[model samples]
Target: MRTPASQRALLVKISENVCYTELVYQRVNKKLSVDWSHSETEAWVQAILRDPDSLVEQRGKNYYVANQRRKSQLTVNSHNYRLITVNRLSK
Candidate 1:
């Protein structure tokens, strides 16, 4: 298991390298119900990943980042840092 400091560093690195495809952009917008541009969406996701309150964990081949303040969770490919999807958390 990684130490908290290492895990946080890893999350920061992943956040810096995160990428999004057109399909993912569309899907995120639909799921999150916000029509942000590609760059805007990317920034939003990165912010979540970098947030100290967010929880980052690896499951299988993906990194799952969840933030309660944002009320959402995001999944990214571990290998390529490609954004897979994001979903709003239900209260």
Candidate 2:
């Protein structure tokens, strides 16, 4: 019989390996790079992360969120920095 799509090794591996955990008593950890991928998934991933909004395609198997910033007139005058936000959700 064919393997159930949800039970596939690739997807299961991604979930087990990609997610991070922290102790409830301690502050959360921060990461600059979300180091998870396969050659097949890379192009699809780029299509999303490269967007101006910093959003990715988020296929049914996985989700990715991102942050982006552009210089603003007020920020330029005030010498402030641009801001960005990134988030993700997956089933």
| Top TM-score hit | 1
Error of 1 at 24 (Å): 0.6
TM per model?
A: 0.92, 0.21
By summed lDDT, the worst window of 10 consecutive residues in model 1 runs over 1-10
For candidate 2, the per-residue lDDT at 82 reads 16
Off by over 4 Å in 1: none
Q: Which stretches of candidate 2 lie over 4 Å from their true place?
A: 1-37, 55-87
Give candidate 1's whole-model lDDT: 0.90
Considering every candidate listed, which one attains the maximal lDDT? 1
What's the lDDT for residue 44 in model 2?
Answer: 33
Clashing pairs in 2: 48-56, 67-85
Q: Put down candidate 2 lDDT per residue, 6-81, tens digits, no spaces.
A: 3243233332333222221121112223343333233333333343443222334334333344211010011111
TM-score of candidate 2 versus the correct structure, residues matched by position: 0.21
Clashes of each: 0, 2
